[model samples]
Target: MDGPFATAFSLIASGDPALMQIIGLSLRVTLTAVLIACAVGLPLGAALALARFPGRGAVIVVFNALMGLPPVVAGLIVYLMLSRSGPLGSLALLFTPTAMIIAQTLLILPIVISLTRSVVEDLWAEYREQLLSLGAGRLRAVPTLLWDGRVSLLTGVLAGFGRASAEVGAVLIVGGNIAGHTRTMTTAITLETARGQLGLAVALGIILLTLTLTLNAVAWGAGQWARGRLG
Candidate 1:
């Protein structure tokens, strides 16, 4: 353990290009997945919350349940669906970054929807009466409510990104952890650890933790700044 720890520290201090590439690739995939999640999930969540159609409650319930789904299950589903003999086999997306991104989007979409729904619900409760009293129609109030809940929406997005970036099981299965190709920090850590190369694994693990912490810190600071400006 001590030897692995020492080697891990040395690897970080050495500025290894391979390690940097892994980190960069992980960041790229996670950022892309999160952005895609927001683009699709935000409006859907807001609409689900503000709309008064039948079965809205059922949809919210399903989304909330999906928010707690196991990542390994999601990985298995994507792997099966994108495998060579599967329906999407012709696209040849398996073991690729795009596949990993797709799996991650599936994993985090529920979180985005559920969290954003909660945010919208709160805003609706607070402002619905006032907006309606002022002769504002439903369409006018929807955007206003969303704007007021911007901080919560941002927090939800940060939460989704955090979830996507930290996930290992799904990316590992769907991406195949191919070295110098589909390899990401999480996948690298898992492969190295399995191969008993504790030093490399621990090094990669440290890198992942550092990236996650840095991202969360930035999100927190940004959310605080946004709230202050709004106030």
Candidate 2:
């Protein structure tokens, strides 16, 4: 443990190019996927909060269930779709960062959508009558509720980011974990472990743990801020 921790600290202190590259690609893929998920999920979730259509309960159930979708299943789905004989194969996105991004997006999208829906729905439940009295239809009230719920919604976003950053199976499948191309922190750690590079793997694990801790701290701070505002 001491030796591995020493190596981990040394790698961090030295800024090894390979380590930095893995970190950069991990951030790039995860951030892009989070952005895409939030962009699509936020408004859609707000709409789900406001909509009163039939079978809405079913839709909600499906999304809530999807929040638990396995990483490997998500990877396999992307792999199949991106394979040469698959419908989207023509785009040649398989075994690339873009493919990894897509896979992560799928994994995290349900989480974003489900949590956003819960936040906005609670806000709507409290404000619906007032919003209606103001001549604002349900559709027109979405943005207002979404804005008001922004702090709470941030927890969902950060959760999605954490999920994306930690996931190895999905990205590995779609990105091929190729050196200097698709390799990311999590996948690199997996490879390093397999090759008995325990020190490097432990180093990468330390970095990933730090990142997750930071994200959770941010989420906790946001929750506190929201509570203070409400108080």
Candidate 3:
């Protein structure tokens, strides 16, 4: 058998079209999902942290629990919802990139919301009185707390991205892993390894690892910058 590392490097250096396509699709889907999650999650989380309505505690508990949702279960639910006989089947999203985006977004929403809530809540506790004394209401204070806690919220976004990028179960069920279509890095790796194409699988794995590490590095740098500002 060819050494996996050597073969991986060779494939990468050769700019294999299939590998490039998989990598591109993976980035596009995951990044889009994360952005949509952030749009919904950040506002919802800030509201949860600032509001004190009845049943708020229960709502918070449910969201926190959902952070531990199983990937396969998520995939199953999405699959059912998008199936031909299912509720959203009219949209014809099943076995497509859109379905994959929906699946990943669902998978990461709870994580983003929970972590954002935690960060915003903590910052709100510190800034509440100050904001109130300055004539700021809860609505006005939400933005302030979110801005102050942006670094931590960013970390949460990165966490969601990581979860989206690494997961295969949900996307596989929804996307169908069609070549040059819905296939992504994680799904491609699974396909390659299953077909005993170790070199391609290893190459994809390396690319995935590199992307994840780069994201973490960016988060780390942002955290450091925020700390410096705080100091």
- Candidate 3 on 124-155: residue-level lDDT in tens? 88998999999999999877888888878888
Q: Clashing pairs in model 1?
A: none
- Supply candidate 1's per-residue lDDT for 32: 92
lDDT (CA) per prediction:
0.85, 0.91, 0.90
Q: Rank the candidates by TM-score, best first.
A: 3, 2, 1
List TM-scores for all candidates, in order. 0.91, 0.94, 0.95
- After superposition on all C-alphas, the RMSD of every candidate to the true structure, in Å, is 2.1, 1.7, 1.4
Residues 121-153, model 2: lDDT tens digits: 999999999999999998899889988888889
Q: On a 0 to 100 scale, what is the lDDT of residue 147 in model 3?
A: 83
Model 1 lDDT per residue over 1-231, tens place: 466567767877898888778888898888898889888888788778788888888999999999888888888999999999989999999999999999999988998989888888788888889999998876777678777888778888887888888889999999988887788988888888889988778767776787788888988898899989887
User: Which residue pairs collide, candidate 3?
Assistant: none
Query: Which stretches in model 1 have alpha-carbon errors above 4 Å?
Result: 1-9, 132-136
Clashing residue pair totals per candidate (backbone < 3 A): 0, 0, 0
Better of 2 and 3 by lDDT: 2
